[model samples]
Target chain A: MTNRNNAVNNAQKSWLYRPENHKKLWWGFGLILAATVVVQLFVSVHGHFGFDGWFGFSAAFGFLSCALMVVFAKLLGYLLKRPDNYYDDDA
Target chain B: MLELIFPPAFILILGAFLIGPIRAPLRPLIVLGAPLLTLYTIWQMGDGIQLTAQFLNYEIQLIESSPLRRLFATIFAIMAFVGGLFAFRQAKWWELAAAQAYAAGAIGVSFAGDLITMFLFWELMAIFSTVVVWCGGTEGARKAGIRYAIMHLVGGVLLKIGIEGVMVHTGSIEIQPIPLTNIDGWLILIGVLINAAAPPLSAWLADAYPESSPSGSVFLSAFTTKTAVLALILLFPGQQILIWIGLYMIFYGIIYALLENDMRRILAYSIVNQVGFMVCGIGIGTEMAINGASAHAFAHIIYKALLLMSAGSVLYMTGRRKCSELGGLYHSMPLTALCGIIGALAISAFPFTSGFISKSMISQSAADQHLMMVWLLLLAASAGVFLHAGIKFPWFVFFQKDSGLRPKDPPWNMRAAMVLLAAACILLGIFPEWLYRLLPYPVDYVPYTASHLVTQLQLLLFSGLAFFALLPLMRRTLTISLDFDWVYRRLILSLMNRLICLLSCLNTALRNASNRVFSIIWTYIGRHHGPEGMLARTWPTGSVVTWVVVLLTVFLLFSIY
Candidate 1:
């Protein structure tokens, strides 16, 4: 059974899972980041508010807000989450 | 010449009736053909009240035309076509019939020239949509459909009351723009807000939508809330309360969706979130804001439908809906994966997507109005959209830990429907003018500035980064998050149960008390009249005759006096 499972896994492995492909994906992502940063040199961003004009502000804000959201959601889940069957009786 | 001044909605309604009696193999022709004819009629309509008739003391306008009304009608017609195509073979024939009738209601609402006319179609929508929900054919679906019906019926009653009050107060029934200042106005606003899935009552969308069958959800997503948005744009534009209300809905949707495990429920929550942007725009109430709101609704219906279609396809193929049970589908179902990603990108408002062109207008309007706080919060919500829906949806369902489910793409019709919507998303993003021209107001906004593109990319990509980084925190459990539905689903029901118990107890006590009182009275009477009593004794006849003679004598004496 183990050998059969291994064979299935190997056969299903697409190009996304190759060992060397990981480095290429990272480099591609890095290139995108560099491009966004470099574009800031030529174009003046018209900030809608005070902090939005700062260099890489969107990146920082998006990252921080999302992290905070996840943490807050985790905390909320502690209070609100129940077994999936919580409403089974009523349903 | 078309002599019959037929309402565009009637075509689909007519089709709905005809579909049931028609034989199979040719049924798809009617389903597909009706909406196109309706679209033709909608476009043929010019900007004015087309058909009006007298009903009792008031004039009822059945067809009114304006750019806003036409825009909404166009989308409704398009949705009917796409949804019918998606459900052609998968859904029961009656479900499709009900769905067409439901679409007709939405279209009717869009062109309704008076409150009475709009109300007529509004209830039609409520009834038929419940049928669609019932078509899910599960115990849960039946229950959810009942709840959905009750909620909408209450909303419909509120609306009817408001309409009557307004007509009596103002002596007019014209469907013109109005503010929520009086009791009638406030009632109308509440009624519309219920349909918009505004807070406290917002749980119905999440609670009921996922209970639908795979194709049923695709039809469910399109009409009801967008029509509410249309009504809000028409009637309550610039109402300041809507800003705060829309903000609450946005965050509520994000938080709840973040904690959700069911794939479609997450999409449902995000519907509330997407509608929030439009609601906020309506609150701003500037021409640009109204344009933004309407255009967003137009863009929203397409992409939201696309997202739900992808999720529905997954549910259809795997017979599983929980994200915990789905993954590694990208290996076998590349088309579904790609389409799902496109939908996710459009929803996130990533650069050069439908969301970017339309949603930015609302935030831009906020900034243009110098509402600094609103602008910032909208900006954050934009990123949060990516966090919750854009990443969380596709990542878990298609790319997360392999659950060994190898479901393939759905049937050709479903795939064609999804691809068509996906193409619309990209096309709208690439060319905003096509949609902008359809807006009720003229457009001066541009969406593809270099700075705008960079910032949006930075925001979306970093949010994506945050998603991967915080992956451990978002781990799906076999759990559901409680929402405001608890009040109705649990608290209200339990309260009713307790009240019934108390009432029955009171009823039993009252019955016992009444029985005791009657028995006591009967016993007293029995004692007085029993055989051993003085009146019932053997000497009673002689005494009764003597008493009668004595009473007669007394009566004669009194009469003589």
Candidate 2:
């Protein structure tokens, strides 16, 4: 059933194609992420720093820091960004 | 009485030159065989100086053997073999040859017992790696290669100065733990750091790497920086400064990676980020940390190559590299996508990945030292790694809104290379003991402990959540974020232009002012002395008599005096 391109069957048949699957994927992914934090209650996680051992600390820290980094990178892009061809004439 | 007259470097170096002139069919054999042959030579020798040769006045170790170097050389050979396979069919003959020589240079550095030998091999990598960059054969590659060479040569000069200084001062060319009491030691560290793609000069990696050909990028990904890591482990262990430098490199890499749109460049910046961990580990300088750094270098080379191979495949098939221009590729390039995700996960240190095993040792070492702030920043870096490389690379390149482009996985050789490296990543992750055993120091730290696994998973998964939540901001743009290279590449050049302009204006004004003063003087003289002047006119008889009387009076005054 596979063509040389490998997607003759895959393109439309891919679960990622369906509108409803998007919601399903998000919900499932969100559940797994939440469970990682929830699993901490039972997993007896030890953090190197005492502050790190608090419930959901890594989750909160990971999310917040990443958010801040993304924002920061965006801010940096405003200053440093140039068209991909910015160096074309120079080169 | 035996001498390694050929030097172990000769095998691949010879192979590199032979690859050019040999019959077309036999060239591929040399391409693959040379590195393997060198690897065999490496394992054949045991620790300490295997062979020494007199160079001018000094006896230098032509080949030094240790468990540490043997490990590095082994991976380098493997990388060359797989890289050759991935590249041979697609790359220019010269490119393949140059890359072989480049690998030889890395191997030579690995076993170099003296700073002199290391410096020689170091420049060899510099020269041929530049050639490999030129192998991209694009206008961009041409320019970027120039920058890459200049940076490496600058680093090489620093290293050479340090080595010569040590030789003159201490009378020892032997590569040993150098003291930073003097400028020489710091020069050596700085020299090595520049090659490690440490900050202010880190842009060269991101700038030059992505410009190489798809296959060229694959080879480019492996050698230079990892060789620098090996050098650091050998020369500068326990230097506390590396920890801060390493930390700076990590975030700088991640931030630039996030702001990047080029597919290969994202991976390039992550190279700096991953090496940061190794550098930080070397700074920790405990047996565990050194072991971690050495092991991570091994693990990183494979996965980073895998990541690039996947990206290279996409580029090869679609002829597109910008993430903004690429999407929905997973639909067709399932295998590439899978391998890429595996590489991404491994890089992120997700459980059951090589990164998980190797990188944790560094963090554990930091924790053991009770380096609270350093340890915390490292944890955040871990999350950031997952955010930028783990999720962002694959999400944008493969799974973003469909670009409606469906290209198949690359040719069989490329595919085979990817699969093999992907397998290596997983196998090493599952059985890190094999890698751990090869470390320069013993590794007693366990990687799969339950608490460690739970926390790492939480960190990575939550980071994943952050990536999607900030998806709007993370969207690919057709732009590049500037770095320190901007100073040299744009600012300095522009300033030089302005300086020249200012200098030229001053030059013109000076010329005009001088000409004006000369003309004024000329006019005054002409007014008095020319044909129309009082002295030259027919009516000048009265003025001549007056001048004669004044001259007589002046002569009388002088005579009286």
The best candidate in terms of TM-score? 2
Q: Model 1, A51-73: lDDT tens per residue?
A: 78888888888889888889999
Residue-level lDDT of model 2, residues B477-517, one tens digit each, is 88888788889988999999999999999999999999999
* Candidate 1 DockQ, CA atoms: 0.69
User: What fraction of the true interface does each of the listed models get right, in terms of native contacts kept?
Assistant: 0.86, 0.81
The most accurate candidate by DockQ is 1
TM-score of 1: 0.90
lDDT of 1 at B204: 90
Q: Which structure among the candidates has the greatest lDDT?
A: 1
Off by over 4 Å in 2: A1-13, B1-7, B538-561
iRMSD values, candidates in order: 1.1, 1.0
